[model samples]
Target: MLNFFLVNRLSSQVRILSSLLVMLLVFILVTVLVKVDTSTWTMEFFALSLVCVAILSGASNVLTASVFGVTGRFPLQHSQSLISGQAMGGTVSALAAILDLTIASNVTDSALAYFLTADVFILLCIAAYLLLPKITYSRFFGLFSYYMNLPDEPTDSSSSEDPVETVDVSSSKTNSPPIIPILKKVKVLAACLFYTFFISIIIFPTISAGIESVEKYTGSIWTNKYFTPLTCFLVYNFADWSGRQITTWIQVPGPNSKMLPVLVFLRTFFIPLFMFCNYQPRKHMYEVFFKSDIYPIIFITLLGMSNGYLGTLSMVYGPKVVPKELSEGTAIVMSFFLGLGLAIGSAFSSVVHLI
Candidate 1:
């Protein structure tokens, strides 16, 4: 919520640049923190890490809104690519985590090196953002987005002059944006985005993390130590990325069609399917209907892929639902609802645990 407020009041460039800087700072902090033997400072280490993570997450929320607001101005493909790239980043991070766990002998040093490497990339992003104005592609869209924010002019039935040429330069000061109507225009898609992530947050890492391999009788390391990471993290992340990529080729349940929300709401069924898996230590639901590893592998893949595909469609459709002039505000509002979904779903998870 704080991040949402900041994005509303701050300039786009300022929000994005600050987020990148915060990311860089986090990388540095984590890099240095890992070097110390955390055994001695366990409480302090974890406490500080939590604080950093909270701050970084806020920055990330701001960045999401900023990306949507900026890309909402351009052609549809740009927004689609932005979402795909985010999924790709998650895939890379998952791969890196697995590699670090399996091969790195010195966990501390390897993790530190990982942060350092990430910092270098953050630096590159900062430089690229700084240079964005110099690039014609970006400058063109930046100006175009500015032009989009102008208020609608009075229609003149008889005036034959080019409308673009007659835009009053001072009109921006006279007209205030209609936030309520803009939000109303996008409320349906905003609901789609919210419920999409809501279902995702409720299932993942909560019910999904509890799911275990049924092949535990073998006592193999693959079924024990690596099963969750491989089946849960790698499979889900890759599938999610693949789903985002699939949108480039095929986007079904078109933006405004009723089919979109129908498909999104259908994902709720996955929760029960997961609950009946080989999830250990169930207090309330004891029946393990799905005993084979295959069920979870399939379910998680579906969960991740559906999330990617449906969520992206909602986001891409948000800014376009309203007039071009209101696109940026609409995009930011979509991001807020996305955050709201994740928040409510997270709270609901504890209720699920009690049940």
Candidate 2:
């Protein structure tokens, strides 16, 4: 909700750069405070650090909304690029965790390296945003400009008295235009997005993380330590990234196609697949139908792939379906649906874990 408001209030570049700057400051402060000795003021510093973390977390959604708004202006292929980049970040994080696990011995040293690396990355992003306007295509597309509305076009110039009809890009503009009509335009894409993420999040990290190798008792480091990270996180993230990249070249089942929703709803089957994997410490469900490691690797990979493909397709198609003026609003609405799906999925995941 805050994201929707902030995106409209500020330009895309401004909001993103501002958020990145704040995050950079928070990171520096946290690094300084947490490294200090544990004195009477330790708790005070810790509390302050938590508050800073919360602020950064709160600003994250706004940053996301702003970026999506910019991409919403351009062609759908650009949106696919942004989606692919996001998935690539996840893949990189998974790999970095594996690297940290292999090399870092002390938790303090590991955390220090982690936060410092993040700070540098934020700086890089800030620089990138500063340089984005230099791109010819970005300028040509007016990516930074807010589209108020498209000019009215007449169907027949000779027959009509006034060929080009006047559009009410009103002088007395409200904070936003009528939302009901906009909602009606992107309703199907929104639903597809919600269900896709809902299915993806319901089983991921909760049930999937608990899944163990069938050869757990083998006692090898590969099976005990590296198996889940490699097969689960790394593979899923890589496949997801691949799926997003594929959208740039091949966006099958077109924007208005009915097959899109059918394919999205079919992803619900992945939930049961993950649940039925070799989940450890099986308390309630006695059966583990997928008895081999290969099953989980395949299942998790497919889950991530489908999630990336369908999720990206749905989001890119959102702005395309609406009028130029309403693209920003529809983009924000699509983001809301995506978040709503994640929220609902997170809530359901807890229930699945308990059961």
Candidate 3:
């Protein structure tokens, strides 16, 4: 049974193959765009391109989560899987930030960053291929079939002659409720939509504003130099806390749990801090008072900390509240909100610059 579990736990080669195909499709699409129409591409094109990329990305994540959830070891071994995924995600985000910063610093070109991102993704595929040699797909499939066939809850029987009766009663009770309640599903869906809107209306604009401010004030377009990797680290920590807190709240066997509320409170405190830190004191004073202004380093630091906290909570708990089956769908919705926010914010910034 242990061996079977281990075998099934390994990610399938078919998944890796599918991911590779998706990557190839993305690469081809990008290559075609670059080669055929260089000057004609616009922000709308970029937005559409991102939407496709996001859909593929969301599909990949959903596949991974489905595999993990199938193992039925959530909040234990599954927690580790979730952490690994988040860590990898954070690492990729940090790399992207570094590349952006490096391009801004003139140490590398923007094309180089793009190339590196593609290359790294290819390398990940190769790594997956190499790792696949140790695990047999046949064994995994067999294990998966076996596990799926097993009853979810054990039978409770007092007599040896009534095995079929026992199984019938057990199955009836076990199957009485759907895995998720309809009300819970509605709540989760509503929460996901609310979060998506919140990101669009609040988070992305704030980020874009901060980036623009950093570029104007620091005379550098590399916003990551001032924020990215640092924010990523802080955000990941917050995500970690949020994931654990939500999992604990949901899975705890008792009624007197205080973990969920505490986690929420911590998450709330970070948002204001982020806003205050990125308040652009110098610009406000210069425009209003028409004088040399002082930058509040402490305020900025607090803002960074707050941003981290908010980011972590949103990323972690946001998905937790979402139905497991709809995690990928929720992520796609979130991505849509992010894209919308970025577009609005960027347009607003451009308008402000024009004025």
TM-score of model number 1: 0.88
TM-score of every prediction relative to native: 0.88, 0.89, 0.49
Which digits, one per residue and each the tens of the lDDT, describe model 1 over residues 198-270?
9988888787877888898799998988898888888888888888778777878887789998998999998
**Model 2 Cα lDDT, one tens digit per residue, 212-275:** 9999899999999999899888998998999899898888998889999999999988877887
Q: On residues 246-339, what C-alpha lDDT tens digit does candidate 3 reach at each position? A: 4423443211234433433443343343343433433432332212112223333433333333333333343344333333323333333334
Q: Each prediction's Cα lDDT score?
A: 0.79, 0.80, 0.40
Per-model root-mean-square deviation over C-alphas: 4.4, 3.9, 9.7
Off by over 4 Å in 3: 1-20, 31-37, 41-51, 103-143, 146-256, 280-355
Q: In TM-score terms, which candidate is top?
A: 2
| Candidate 2: regions farther than 4 A off | 37-53, 144-174
User: Candidate 2 at 223: error in angstroms?
Assistant: 0.8
- On TM-score, the stronger of 2 and 3 is 2
TM-score of the candidate numbered 3? 0.49
Runs of candidate 1 exceeding 4 Å displacement: 1-9, 37-40, 142-177
Each model's backbone clash number: 0, 0, 1
